[model samples]
Target: MKRKKFASLMPREALKRSKSAPTIVVIGPSTSGKSTLVYVLVNHRIIGFITVGIGDKSQTTIIPCNFAFDERIEKDEHFAMRIRIKDFSAKDVHIEILEQLAKLFASNELSTEDTLDSIDVEWFQNILEPKDAAYHLGKMEKQISIEDFKESIADVLCAIENAEPSFSERVKVKKKELAQQKVKISEIRRMVFEDIWGSISDDLLARYFKWLDYIGENITNNLNLLLGEDNSLGGIHDYSANEDDIFMYGGTILQTLFDPFEPFSLIVEDITLACRPRTEIITRSDENIPLRFCLRDTMGLTQIGMDSNSIKDALDIALNCSPDSILLLMNLEERDDVIAESCDAIAEKLSKATKLDVPVNVIFTKADRLIGNLVNKSNKETVVLKQDDYDATILGAIDNMEENIRGYLTKLPQKNGMWLSLRYLDEGIDPIQRALKNQGSDKFERFTPTGLYQNIDEIIRETQKRILPEGIETPLFVTAIDADAPAVEMKVEGKMISNIFNSIQNVLTEDNSVVNGYTITTKYTLSGRSVVAYYNKLQRGQGHTTRANVYGNFSINMKAMLNKILCNEIPDFLTLYESQVIGTVVDNLIDIELEHLVQEFDKNQHYKDLAFCDINPALISKWSDKQRNTQILHQAIRQYFSSSEKYYMVMDKVAFNLSYGNEQIRKIIDGVYQKPISYDQTMREMQDTFKKIFATQAFSAIIAKEIGDAMTDLINKMIILV
Candidate 1:
C-alpha cells in the first residue's frame, strides 16, 4: 500500500509571530473536548495533522497553538493556550504557584518586569521528537512477537470454538449475518504496518477484535501498556468503536502517549482550536447580526488555580493578546465541585470575583452526553419518559448546576446587577415604543435601560414557564457539543454560539445591547428548542423497538448579557474587593505577623555558636553583630502592591525591588526586636533587657552576694547622708 504524506507542525518562524487580530482565547478544564471542538470547526485541516487525544487519561496540550483559518490573516496573531508557562517540567506542576500567579495578576502583584525578556522559541523547537514516537507507535502497537501474538489469537478462537455461551449457536439463532473472514491474525498485518494507512475489510477486522475480546482483563491491560497508551481510559479492544475508526483511534492513543505538546504545555505555551462561522442571526424586527472573531485556547486551570490567584506576567500576556472577549467551556460530566472551581477560576482570571469578568461567556460542553446518561438510566427498566418529564429532567440538572454556584452568583449589589451600568448607551431605544408613547401613551417611552429590562422580563414571562432561579445571576448558557457536527448544526447547538461573538463585540465596541444600533431587540430567544436528535432503539430490546425524536433547548443565549455587567471603571468593585489590594497596610500587617516573636535566649545566635569567652569584642561586633547563628529567619512578605499596576518584593539586590517600585526589605536582627515581627512579645523582651542592664545588673554581682542586705548596703555605699 502506498503511504500518504503525514501532516506536520507549523514552522518555528511561523510560531514566533505575534497576533494582530482581535483574539478570543478558549480555556477549559482537561477533557472538556476543547481540542475536538476546534478540529470540527476548522473542519478536517487539523484532524489528520494533529492528534486531539480523545480517549487518553494524561494531558496532551503543551503550549498555546495559534490557529487561523483565513489565508489573508497571519497565523501568529491568534493562539490556543495552556498557560502553564515555564520550562517543560511536568512533574513539577504547582497549582499553588499558578494560582499565586493568577492572584497576583488579579490583585496586581505580578508585572512584566518579572517575566523573561522573550519566550525561548529555540527551546520549543527541540520537542518535535514526538513525531518519531508517533511513527513507531502507529506501526508497532498491533503486535508482540509472531509466536506470542499467534498464541493470543489462538486463545480467542479457542474460547469461541469451545464457547460456554455457545457463540456459534447464538450467531445462527439470530438473523445476524456471520462474518466470512476465515484468515488468521498474521494475514491481516501485511495490508498495513501503520494504523493511519488502513482501508481494510470489516469482516476481517471483526474477526480480529473477536479474538481480542476473549482475553482476560489482566492480559488486556498488559497489551495496552505494550502499545504505549494508558489503560486507565479503556482497554485495547474497544468494541464500541466502528471498524474503520481504528486509525483515528490509534492516532489518539499515540498522541496521548507521545504527544509533542504534552511537554510544551508544561513549558509556557499551547497550540490548537480554530473556526468562526460566517453565518448571521436575524434580530427582533428583522436585522442581521454577523459573527466574525478569531478563537484561541489556553491552558486549563487546576482545581485550586481557578478561583484565587495572584500573578503578573499572565496579565501582561492578557494585555498583549487584548482579546475582545473570553469564552469559558465547562464539561457537563464534571462533578459539582469541579463546576464551582471552573467558574471561580474564570471569574478571578477576568478580575471579577463576584461575577464573571466583562465580555465573557460560559459555555457548557458535553450536554448531549449528560442527556444520554439520564435517558439511558431512565431506560434501564423501560425506555420511558414523556415530553414534559424529559424537559423537567434536564431542567432539574440545570437547577443542580445553578445551586452549586449560588454563592458566587449572587445578585448584583446595585442597579439590579446593571450596577455600574454603562455610562453611555450605544444601542438605540426601540422606535416602536418611542412612536407609541409619542402617539398615544405619554408615560412609557423609556429612555433608560429600565425599559429594556422590563421588555426582557415580559418576553421571558410570555415565552417559557421555566427559568433558572433568580439567585444565580451570572450570564450563563448550556450548549451540547457533537465534536463533528455540521456548521449549520454547530454541535447539538446553533443559537448561543451564533449569537455570542456578536453580543460581545457589541459590548466591547459600543457598550450596547442590540446589533441594529436601535433599541434592545425583543426578538432574541430567551429560551427555545435549537437541538433536535432522532434516535431509534436497538431491535433486540424487549420493551419493543421504537423511534422517537427529542427536542431540547440545549443551547441558550441571553443577548446583550455583557452590556449589563461590563464596566471597566466600576468603583463598587474597587471598594468591594479592597482586601485584594496589597500595599503599606497589608505589608505592615504581614511584617507584624512574621517578625517581633522573641526566641528563647539559649537559641539566640550570640549564645548558640560560641561560649562566653569565645566572643571577643570584634566577634561581638560581628554578631551584634554576633557570630553564633546563621540567620534563616528572613523578612516575610514579597510582592507588596504599590499601585494598581505595580508590585514590590524582597530580593538579592536591595535595589532589585526598586525596579518595579518595590520596597527594600531590611534584614531582621536574629532573636531581637530589629523590626517587630510580633510587636507585643518584642516590647516585653525589650523591657526585660532594659531592666537587667541599667536597673539591677548594673550593680556589682559579687558585692551584692557578699553583703547581708544587698539593697541596704548598695544604698549606704552610694550616699548615707543624702
Candidate 2:
C-alpha cells in the first residue's frame, strides 16, 4: 500500500525550482544491468535481453544513455487513478500532451483522506540470464610467467630498433628465436586480465577486471565516454636487418601493443537518455517548481595502466564532480570485500577531486539472485534457507562489509575521520563520501541508511544552504524480475529502488543544477542564411581532388574533408555530412543529458555557433558501429563548438549549413559570397544587419526545432554501415 501511494506522487514533487534537470551520474563496471534499469525506469517493462540486443547489456549502452518514465495518467470518477509508464519521447509525447490537456477540462475530487496508494506493474517477463563477464577469467590457467612475457616483448622491440638494414641473416635468426617463444592465446589473455584488473580471487583487482568493460566503457561513452599506447628495449643485439626488410617491421610496435584484443571497444562514448515522469499532485502552496535533471552513466574500475587511453576521459567525470552523495553499486554474486575496496578507491579519488565529504552508499544489484540460489541449488545443497533467513543474511553481510570498506573510507589524519562513517548531517543533510579529511577530528557518527524524507522540499531547502554547489549521488539496487524464475515471497516494492528514484528525483529538481535563464549578448551572422544548396552524394568529391578516396566500393572521405576545412575550402558536399553529424550529436549525447538537455540548451545557451566534428567516416580499415560513429561525430561537434577560434572564426564563417543534390535544399545559392573576410571590417559593416537579426528570436528557436527535425527526419531513412 505504501508503494502504491509512493508511485502515485508525481516525480516533480521531489524537486527544487530550476531551469534544467539536475544530473545523477550512474557509475559502475560492465554487466551491471544499468541499461535495462534505465529502460525499465522509463518504459516500466523488462523487454527480454534479445530485444535489448545481444545478451550483453554492457554493449547496448554505447554512450552514457539515460532512461526516463513516460506518464499516461487517467483519472477515475473516484479518487483512485491508474498511472501507466512510458518513455517521455516519441508518439507517447503526443498522447501524453493530450492527456495533460484533458485533465484541465475534468475536475479532480477533493481528498478527504490524504492516504492513497498506487501500485506499479511490470508488463513483460525478464529473460535476463546470469550473464557473467569474469566467470571464466579466474579459472584460466596461469602457467605463463608474466615477467617472462614482458621480457620477450621487450626483446622483440630491441631487435626491431637495433637491426641494421644492410645485414639480414643475424636479424632473421633472432626473429626466429623470438617466434619460438610464441605467446599462446591463453597466456596473452591471462596477461591482459592481470594487467588490466590486477591479480585474481584475493582483492579489488579481480572486481576491477570484472567490471572494466561496463564502468570502463561508461567513461569512454559515460553510457555513450566507455572512454580509451607503446615503446621499445634490449637483449636482441645479434639481430640484423637487410635494407629491403625495413618495411616488414613497420607498425610492428602498434600491432604488438594491440595484438591481445580486437581494436573495437564495446561502447564509444558517454550517452545520457533524458526523461520526464509525471505522477505528482499540484500543491496549492508550492511555488518555484524546478526542472527535472539528467542522469549520466559512467564506466567502472579496472587495473588502468598509463599506456591505455580508456581511463583518460573517464577520470574527469567519475572523480571530479562535486556530489552530495555517491551511490556505489556492488554485485551480490561478487565478494563483499572486493566491492567495498573498489568503492573506497572511488570515494578516495572523489574526495581528492571535489574535496568535499560525499556519502558513499553501496547498493547491491541482483539481490533477488540470492533467492534464486534456493531453487537452483536445492538438489545440490544440503540445506536451503527461507526468505527471512536470506534477508537476515544480507543485512548481516552489510554490517560485515562496513568493516571491510571502512578502512579506506576513514583514512583521515590523526583520527578515523568524522563521517556518518555515518557522520552527522548539515541542514539536516551531510555528504556521504566527501573529503572526509576536512570534517574535523570527530569520530564516525554512526552507519546506516538515512530514512526517507517525507517532504522533498526538505531536501531542496537543505541543499540551498551550501555556499558552493554540490550534487547528490543516490545508489539504487534495481529489482531483478525473472519471468522464468519461481515466484518469491519478497514484495517488488520492498526493494530499495523506490527510495533511490525518490532521492534521485529530489536531486534532479535542484535550482543550481538547472540552467540559469540568459539574455542574448552576442552578435548574429545571417548573411549566409540564404546560402542553401541541394546535397548530392556524387558532388562530394567535386570540392577537392583528395575528397573521393576509395574505400572498398564506397567513398567516405574524412581525411580530405578535414584537409579542406583547414585550408579554408568549405565544400558543398559537407552540407550532407554536417547534417549527418548534427543528427548524430543530438541523437546521442557524449556524457550529456537527453530530454532536459534540449530544454536546457534551448533556454539559456541558444544559437550555438554551427560547426562540425566527427562521426566515424572511417577507421584503419572500414566504418565502425553506430555507437562509435555517433560518439565520434558528437565529440567533433562538441570540440568545434567549444573552441572560440574554431567555432567563431573558421567553420561558422565559411560553412553555413551545406546542402547537396536536392536531398536537403532544392534551391541553389549561386553567386555565393566568395570573398576574403576581414573580421574587424566585416563586423563593422554587418553591425546593423546583425542588430536586425537579433531583434527576432527566430535563430534562437530554430535550433530546438532543428534538433527535433533531425530526430524525426532520420526516422524515415537509414544510413547503412557495412
Candidate 3:
C-alpha cells in the first residue's frame, strides 16, 4: 500500500510559531456516545458532528485518539481564520477512572491537586511503536506455524460442519483448553516483577491485577461472545474485506486505515487517556489558517473499578490547561430527576476542579430520543409531519430541558448551557452549527493564585480599618493625681497591661466567624506604648479619667442609711440605667451590622481556597493582633457602667438599715398641728430639708471615687494577665 506518515507530536519550533489553541475536554459517562459524536464531526467538515450510535453494539475505544482540524469562523471579518478543534475519545481504562472520580466528586472528596505520579505523556507514548503498512499486513495471518494453523482451522471447520457438537459448544471446549493451558497468575506476576517495568509499585500491580480479573470475569466473556458470533466481524466465513486488501496493496489491517467508509473499533477496553496534539492547515476560499491543538478524551466518571491514578492525571491536566471552557455532555435518555442530580454533582466537581471561575457549557445529548417521542405522539394528533404544528411543542420541550439544566447548574459557581441531537438531520435546525457558534468565547477570566494572595492582602487592610477607630491613638483612659505620682498613662505603659487591646485582638484573630471565607489571614497589633502616651496627654486636660471618693470613718447610722440607698435597691436601679446606655450604643452603630461587613468580606474571598490552612500564617498573625486590640477597646466602653454596680450594692445595703421613721415624721406633724394647725404644709417643708442633706456632694463623690478605682484596678489586672 502507498502509505502516508502517521500523525506524531508537533515539533517545538512549530509549536512556538503557531497560535495556541484553547482546549475543551469532552467528558461524560460510558455509552453516552462521546466518540460517535467526535467521529461524525471529524468526517463532515461542513456543518458539525452527530451522536447517533454507530456499529451494531458500541465497540469500546482502545486508544486515546486525536482528531485535530481547523474549524472555519466565517461570521466576523476579524475572525477569518479557522479555530483549532481537538476531539478526544476515552478508552475503557480511562472511563473506569472517571467513574471513580464521579463517586469522589459526589462525596466532595476529589480535589484539583490530586497527582498521577506514574501516568504521563511518556507513559502513553511508549505503549506501542508506530508501524507502517508492511508491519500491520504481516499481523493479518495467524501467529502459530503454518502447519498447526491449517490443522486447527480444518478441525474447527469440520466441527462446525458436522454439528455433532454445535459451533458454540466447540468454541467453549477450545476456550476451556486454552484456559487450562494458560500460565499461572503467580508465574505471570513473577515475570512482570522481573521485567524492566518493575518500577510499577506493588500496590499498583495489585490494582492492575484486580482490573484484569474484572475484565476476565465480566467483559471478556461478553466481548468474546460478540466476536465469535455473527456481529462486528460480519460472520466467520465472510471474508469480503479481501477486496480492500487487494485494492490497498496490503491486507485487512492496512485496508481499514486507507478506507474512509470502513467501521473500525478504535475504543480500547483498557489503558487510560492521554492528550495527542496534531497540526492542520485549513484552507478556505479566501485564506489558509494553520492551527495547532491537543485533544484529550477524558474517561467516563460513571463506571466501576476505576483507577485513581488515571483520574488524578485527567484532573491535573484539565485544570493545568487553563482551558478556555469546559464541554460537559450528559445523556438525555435518563429521567429528569437523574439528569438533575447528575448535573448538580458534576457542577460541584467542576466548580472545585476549576476553582469555580471557568465557564462551563452543559450539553444534553440523545436529543434524537426526545424528537422521536414528539413525532410518535404528534403522529397520533396529526396526519403529517408539520413544522408549524410541532413548533410550540418542540420549543416547549427545549425550554423545559434548558430550565432543568439551569435548575441544577444554578447551584454551581458558573452557569452556561445548550442541548443537542444528531438523529433528525433532515430537520431545519442544525445543532452542530449552534454548538460551534458558541465556541468563540470572551477573554479567559480567573481568580488566579496571585489574585487570591492580593485579595487576602486587601482583606487584611479592610479588617485593620474596621478594628481600630481612626485618630484614637490611645484606646485607654486613666485618671492621674498630678504631673507625677505615676501618671495614668505611664502606669499603664510601664505595667505592659493591654486589657482592652488584647481582648479585641483575640476576637479578631482567633474567631473563625470573623473572616469565614478568607483563607489567607493576618494578625493585627496595637502599640501599647503609644496608647499609654495618648492616655497621659488626655489626663492633662479636661479630657481626664473619671474620679470619685470612697467614704471613710462612717458612723453606724450613716452606714445604715448608705446600705438602704446604695446597695441592693441602687444596684437594680443602675442595671436599668446600664441597659439604656447599651441600647443607645447598639442603635448608633446599627449601620455597621446592616452593612453586612462579614458577608462583604466573604464575597471578597469566594474564589480563594476554602480552608484556614491555605492562608499565609505570617499575614494572619499581624491581622489577628490588631483585630483583638480593637475588640478589647470596644468591650471596655460597652461595659463601663459595670464600675457603678459595686458602689450601688454597698449604698443600697446602708440605705436598707436607715429606715425613715414614721415617729419622727409624726412628731414634726404634731408640732405643726399644735402650733398653727398647718400640718400638710409643714410636713412638705421637712421632707425637702431631709432630701437635700442626703443628696449632698460628699455622698456622690465618695460613691463615684470608689466605683472608678475599682474599675481601674480591674482593667489593669485583666490587661496584665492576658
Candidate 4:
C-alpha cells in the first residue's frame, strides 16, 4: 500500500522543479535509443515519452527535451538524489536554439514554473540566430529569393496535381501512405497551410512575408563565399530594426512553425523538437529525492551534414552545454566502419568543444541481439532456454561485447566502455548509473578550467614540435694538411696554401670545436705514395707502353727503320721513368686534394657532388722537368741516329761486317761460338750503354719534357674522379 501511494504521487512530483539536481548530457549516434533510454529512466515506462511516435522514421525529438527523476542513496546518511535528463532533438539547430532557451528559462525572473513563455528574444540572438538553419538560410538568401523558393514549391505541387487527378484519389493514397509515415505532398501542405499557418497571428505573418522579401531581393552576390565562410550573413543584424522581425527569422521558428518552402525542401517539412528539461521525482529508501539532468541528443555525426543542415548546429549546442560528462552511445546490433567512424568523430568533436577534459563514456546499446550467440558459447545449443537463464545470457554476452568495444574505444580518447540492452533495463541500467555517479567524484576536477588550459597548452606545444624549421642548422667547412712533406704540400710561391687546414688546427688547439662560425673538418693524407703498387696503375694508364724501340746510328737508306725503333723503344723507356717518378708525385697530390673534398662532403649531407682546386702548380713544374728530360732523349736519338753520317756508318757495318765470305761470321754461324761470354757482365755492359745514352743533357731534357706531359694528363683525370 505504501509503494502504491508513492507511485500515485509520481505525476505530481515530476512536475516540480529540482534545482539541486546534476545535469547529464546524453550524446550518441542517430537512433541509438537515447530517447527511449530517458523514458525508462524517468518513468519506468515507454509511453507518452514524446508527442510524436518513437521509431526510425518518427523520431520527433529535435530540440533539447528534458526529463527528471529522483533516486535515494543509503550512504552514511539517507541522501536523496535528483537527476535531470536532457534529451536532444534530431535536428542540430534545435539543440543549439534550445540550449539557450533552456538556460534562460531556468534563470528567468518570471519563470515561477517551467513554461514555453519564458523562451524569448534573448534566446533568439544568443542562441537561435547563430544556428545553422538561420545562418545558412541567411547566407543563401542572395542565392534564393522568395520567387525561386516559391517556384520550386509550385513545380512540386504541379507534379503532384498531375499524378493525383482527383481530390478523392489524393486522399486515398495519402491515408494509406501516412499510416506508414510516408508523407505525401497534400499531407505536407495540410500540415503547413492549415495547421501551421492558421495558428500564427497577423503580426508574425507580416514578419514572415518581410523575411521572404528580404531573401528574394538579396540573391547571393558571391555564392562561393557564402558556402565557405562560417559567418557570412552577419546574423540578425538587420533584424534589430524590428525585434519581432528577428523571431520570424529564428532558426527554429522559421524552419519549424512557419516553413514557407515545404514542397521545395524536405527539411522544411520535418518536425523540429523544442527540447526543454522536464523534472521528475522518485522515492528510494523512503525518501522523496528529485533527480535533475539534461539529455542532449544530436543529429548523428555521420548523417547530419550530409543530408541536412544539422552538423554545425549540433557541434555548437554541444559546445554551449559544456557537459560535465558525455555518453557516447553506439549500437551493438550491427558493426561497420561507418558506426565506428561516427563514434570516433563524435568523441573528437567533444574533446575540442569543451574547455574541461570531460570524460567520454562509451555505451554500446542493443546487447539483446547477442543473446543467441552467447547462449551458443555456453554449449547449450541443443537445450531449450528458460527465463531463469536469461541473466546468464545477458551477462555473458555483455562481457564479450564489452571486450570487443574496449578493443575499439581504447583506441579512442575516452574513459570507459560498457554494453546495455533496454530489454533488461532493470539490470542493464546499472552501468549507466555507475557512470553517472562518477561525474560528482573527485577525479572530475581534471576537466575543470585550470586543467583544461594546461592540457591545451601541452597539445599546442606537441603540435609545434612536429614541424621542422629551416633556421636550426650550423654550417661546416673542411680542409686537409700534408704539413711535413714539401713534395705533396700545396705551395703558392714559397708558402704553403694551408689556411683551410690551419683553421681546423686552430679550433682544435684552442679547445674549441668551430672556427669563424663554421665547424671545421680536416683530413690529412701522407705527402707521398705509401706503396709501389699504388704507382703501378698510374704507370699502366699514362706512362709505360708494352712495346720497346731500338735507337742506333743507321745508313741513310735504313733511317726509316731506325726511326720506327727509336720512336717505339726510346719513348717506351722514357714512359717507364714518367710512370715511376712524375706519375707517382701527381697521384699523391690528387689524393691529398680529394681527401679534403671528401672530408667536407662527409660533414655536410647537402653537398652531393665534389669540386676541388686544380692539381698543385709546383707539382706540375716538377713533372714538366721530367717531361723535358724524356723529350731530350727522343731528340738526341733521332738527331744523331737518323742523320747522314750516323746512318752511313750503321749501313756500312751491317753490309760489310756480315758479308757471306767473311770467315769469322761463318765460324760463328757454324756453332763454333767460344765459351759463352759472361752473361752477367754482358747485361752489365748493356745497362751501362743505355745509362750513358740517357745521361746526356740533350737526351734527359727531351725525355723529361715528354714524360712530364703524360703524367700531368693522368693527374688531371684522377682529380675529378668524385
lDDT of 3 by residue, 512-563 (tens): 5422211112121112122222222211110112121110111112223333
Predicted candidate 1 versus true structure: per-residue lDDT over 587-697, tens digit per residue: 211222212211211224432333334447675556631112222121011111111121100111111111111111111111233221122233233323322321222
Candidate 3 has its poorest 10 consecutive residues by lDDT at 74-83
- Index of the highest-TM-score prediction: 3
Off by over 4 Å in 1: 1-18, 52-56, 71-293, 300-321, 341-358, 373-722
Q: What is every candidate's alpha-carbon RMSD to the true fold?
A: 31.7, 29.7, 35.6, 42.0
After TM-score superposition, what is the CA distance of residue 213 in candidate 3 from its true location, in Å? Answer: 19
Question: What is the TM-score of candidate 3?
Answer: 0.30
Order of all candidates by lDDT, from best down to worst? 4, 3, 1, 2
User: Positional deviation of 141 in candidate 1, in angstroms?
Assistant: 18
Rate residue 558 of model 4 by lDDT. 18
Against the true structure, what is each candidate's TM-score?
0.28, 0.29, 0.30, 0.29
Pick the winner on TM-score between candidates 3 and 4.
3
Evaluate model 3: give its lDDT.
0.31
| Top candidate (lDDT) | 4
Q: Across residues 324-402, which tens digit of lDDT does each residue of candidate 4 receive?
A: 3455556666554555655556655655433333445556666555544564466454577643344444445545766
Candidate 2: list runs displaced more than 4 Å.
Answer: 1-20, 43-58, 66-272, 278-288, 299-317, 320-326, 356-362, 366-722
- Report backbone clashes per prediction: 40, 94, 64, 60
Q: lDDT (0-100) at residue 256 of candidate 3?
A: 33
For candidate 1, the clash count comes to 40
